[model samples]
Target chain A: MKKLMNDPERIVSSFLDGLVAANGTLIQRLEGTDVIVRRSSPPQKVGLVSGGGSGHEPAHAGYVGKGMLDAAVAGEVFTSPGADQFFAAIQAADQGEGVLLLIKNYNGDVMNGEMAQEMAEAEGIKTEMVIINDDVAVNDPDQRRGIAGTVLVQKITGALAETGASLQDAKRIAEKTVSRVRSMSVALTPCTLPAVAQPSFDLAEDEMEVGIGIHGERGMDRREVASSEKTAQLLLESVLKEIPSAAPLALLINGMGSTPLMEQHVFANDVIKQLDRDIQHTYVGDYMTSLDMAGVSLTLLAVDDELSSYLQAPVHTVQWTQC
Target chain B: MKKLMNDPERIVSSFLDGLVAANGTLIQRLEGTDVIVRRSSPPQKVGLVSGGGSGHEPAHAGYVGKGMLDAAVAGEVFTSPGADQFFAAIQAADQGEGVLLLIKNYNGDVMNGEMAQEMAEAEGIKTEMVIINDDVAVNDPDQRRGIAGTVLVQKITGALAETGASLQDAKRIAEKTVSRVRSMSVALTPCTLPAVAQPSFDLAEDEMEVGIGIHGERGMDRREVASSEKTAQLLLESVLKEIPSAAPLALLINGMGSTPLMEQHVFANDVIKQLDRDIQHTYVGDYMTSLDMAGVSLTLLAVDDELSSYLQAPVHTVQWTQC
Candidate 1:
């Protein structure tokens, strides 16, 4: 695959530099930290922090703004941010109100975010955390990995913090959202990192992998290509079964970077037809994406009044804005 | 290319069903109109409406929310929404405050949006428009096609409208933002439409097209693959020379879907190094994308106080919420 870069090793750093240059007013690099924080941070409220591997754009860092995260620690592509970076992000965003860390439930992410939280607590800044394991794809609920549903937690919890909800309350909301959401994904093709210069995995031209992870990890099942309706049904069935919802819910149809909007929309249609509930709200776009991999993921958030209202609230950021 | 769909013809309709199911509270589809509007129609304030083809996710629709657009009209994949759809969007969004149409410079988008504006005017519902022509890669300044910079115009103008700016004032702001913005894109590979079921174009393994349009249109020049830093320089040189600014600017590193965030960031880093002015804000994510095509685009908006403030203003929606 053709790529634009000086060297694979320099790719990430170069991109970070460009990002900093472009959003200098809104964000600044924490000295000695790979974290990016709002330039005017430590607002007079509780601090919120999130981070992970860097490939998921607009997720951890794109979320660092007024109504969302105060700081985002970024790691290399698909690699967890180091604990030191997370600690620095906490330090940068911390106000007297304390800090709350929003972590996805990946082994590396959970461990590193937890370590950073511990370090921040040791420094006398009270820190709390919510581990979001919202993906219902895994067989063991106890080991279910986090996926795109983590974004909903960020949105809800961030809005709560902006409205002066205490850190404890924010943590409560984050945890609540996580518990109420579930996601499943399927991959049509493997993505290649600029540095790696090879597909993450090999698939026959007619094959696809269901329940694939963001980092191109192995999934629950693999099969030949199926119709859009069938694929959508497959994903929805897996997600809905794991997090059965009787009440109104929110649905997110996310493209794994390389999937066309046409395909995503087609999948969304199938999901709606198959889902047997009142979907309160729907987000059909590339919200959480894998880089250049043709695939889609479905996230369903069982919405209560509070989560629904929060989801409807206004926010401002580069990647996503509500009115 | 592998895709998911039972019938290509049913794609748009089915996708709309799922979107409404998920975002029904904030947005509703205008029956038989192919338009999506804010749930609270006859918006309390001046209405903002923008749209084009369906492939560019989040541009025309993901933007419909509390602080931005009141409605968005969608057409078939890569096709402009019809005049009837645009008219329906206007009717749904228009209150006593009038409406403003933010249109890209594409031929079809401009014609159809203009026709709708005329129809609205005939109905005595005040209407205004700002045509965004921001692609610097297209050599002719007077006839440059609109590309991603139109997104900035939508955002800033939408924020202004939400803040109660008059339709005329909103149009002026939108026009100003459009004038101050420039964009250029490059494609490493062509996208395939599910209906067509073929690559948009044949790209050699090592080929790249610089200054490509969003709809898989050919760019100004085709060149062999270059280093990320070199590619960054080539793109920035054109944008900077065309836009010509010594002041800080808001930069967007947009993906045309298939390119991974790793590559986008690497390109962004190179862009920053080549920039001669301060970086005011940066959006490094897939704000607007072309289906599943593997490519990236760069957008620069020269920011003034008003534009920057508006850009930072709050918005609420399902796809994008910055808290």
Candidate 2:
């Protein structure tokens, strides 16, 4: 409860203000809504846009730049932006070529993105949608919540878009990337909401909640806390079962907020040590987060040569970038 | 007390292993030492080498790349690297143009850096040192512990070194940056050392430690918890007192390990709203950290045209990059 915020109700707006202030030259805020867009984009290329609740740092907003999201429509923490806001974002992101919306598989996000796409299409802006459902914890893929694999989706598609791919082509790549990536997360501690002064959930000192969703949704079960080695094995085992022989994949050891890079790196090392497949690349840091949750998630993206090229494409962004 | 580490005794080396696992292509680990060096460097350019402890990640190691430090030596958590390790870094970084060692002004760091400099000089590699003492919290500037401002010193000097500046020129610019920048920090909670089960210190529920050092060193005073506005005002006022009337300075709002980016951004917003001077630039996030400490430090680097140019210069590293 000792967070540095202005007013509980003002957390969303104030955080957006700070985002703009920190990267003013790189991003431009929409006049009214909680939206941030690239300062300038090529008019003849397909534009990319993605967004959701605000608590996940760098997920939607940090990807809004040259090689990733063209615009990000933000809602309150763990809440979706209004459909009208998403429509406005579509309008802002529509280059003459068209626009593609990257929506995570959350109910509110899906609804708003669908509505915005419809609205933009009616306005003759030519819009498409690619819903990402890469979380493997849920029994049904459609019901699975999107997690860190969403970044890989945005990244590969964004890089493809940077190559002047059409809306159809970018959407195709996005859908293909989505099919190849799978992610799962476990939380050692729960995050507190600004609107609520208490944590969303709690665990005992020696226990952890496994298979937890990003928004503190119920996971599979709770278990006694173990060494990072055991933790990495358990998380990776869940992911490896889906594609046992998918060698030469990219690994993303993402921190679910409040986990320091020291521990993230340690967990990453354990993941590598415990992995059975060949890793082409490993990304370690905070890409998506639950507000102050201290935990780590492992994401594996099955990358072929074409997907590898897209992953290697140079990107300049506020958060994720490559030289 | 839950962290994703194998053993507290081996955290330093294991963390370094993970760092290389994540960025193996960009760096190489020195044999038998806890030092990582950029794989390649321009032989004609002055090289930069920095090291202290393992906890302030992305500071020394994350900064090692084409346009930054050529080598970064890491030590045990909250401790200084051995003098031998620094010497190895200097040797690894020394090109024909010579090398410059950037050392923070902690007692252990300064002592080891000086010893390393002597060893490197005895071996006939041209070497110079610039000790960073930018903390405004401590009354005596010479004895002040270097904190986040040390990164500014590395970045500006690294950019200058990229321009093929001579050893003397790079050293001079680093010294100038160290003199111009001043910083202060406040912590809501104390960091727990991995080697120790308990926190370095304790704070009451309604209390905070102002001006705390990165390694949980005691600050000037402990006061009742204040709003982000009041906290920002107090930290900035202390930094501004040392550098009155200085405008157009780059602001670095750094997080101690466990603070969420959402809160950091909120704090950054408050800093802008409360600042009396016009800010030229603002960089926010966990550049330097105490191990899993929930707090922030504000660094103001007074910049003119030359310093501004260096700050804008393009560099590529694992953690930091400018497009």
Best by DockQ: 2
* DockQ of every candidate: 0.48, 0.78
lDDT of 1 by residue, A1-323 (tens): 67666877655566566566656666777777778787764357899999888766657776777677888888888889899989998888888798999888788988898898899889998899888887776888778878889888888887888887788898889988988899998998888776776899999988999988888999988999898778877887787776655768988888777666556766887788788788777777666767667888899998989999888776655445664
Model 1 chain A lDDT-worst window of ten: A314-323
- How many backbone collisions does model 1 have? 30
Instruction: List model 2 lDDT by residue over A256-295, tens digit each.
Output: 9999898998898899988867788789999999999999
State in Å the error of residue A212, model 1.
1.5
Q: What share of the true interface contacts does each candidate keep?
A: 0.75, 0.74
DockQ of 2: 0.78
Expressed as tens digits, the lDDT of each residue in B72-180 for candidate 1 is 8888888888998899888888887888888888889889988998999899889888888888877776678777787778778877887777878998898889879
Scored by TM against the true chain B, the candidates give 0.95, 0.98
The local lDDT score (0 to 100) that residue B228 gets in candidate 2 is 85
> What's the true lDDT of residue A273 in model 1?
77
> Which consecutive 10 residues in model 1 chain B have the weakest lDDT in total?
B314-323
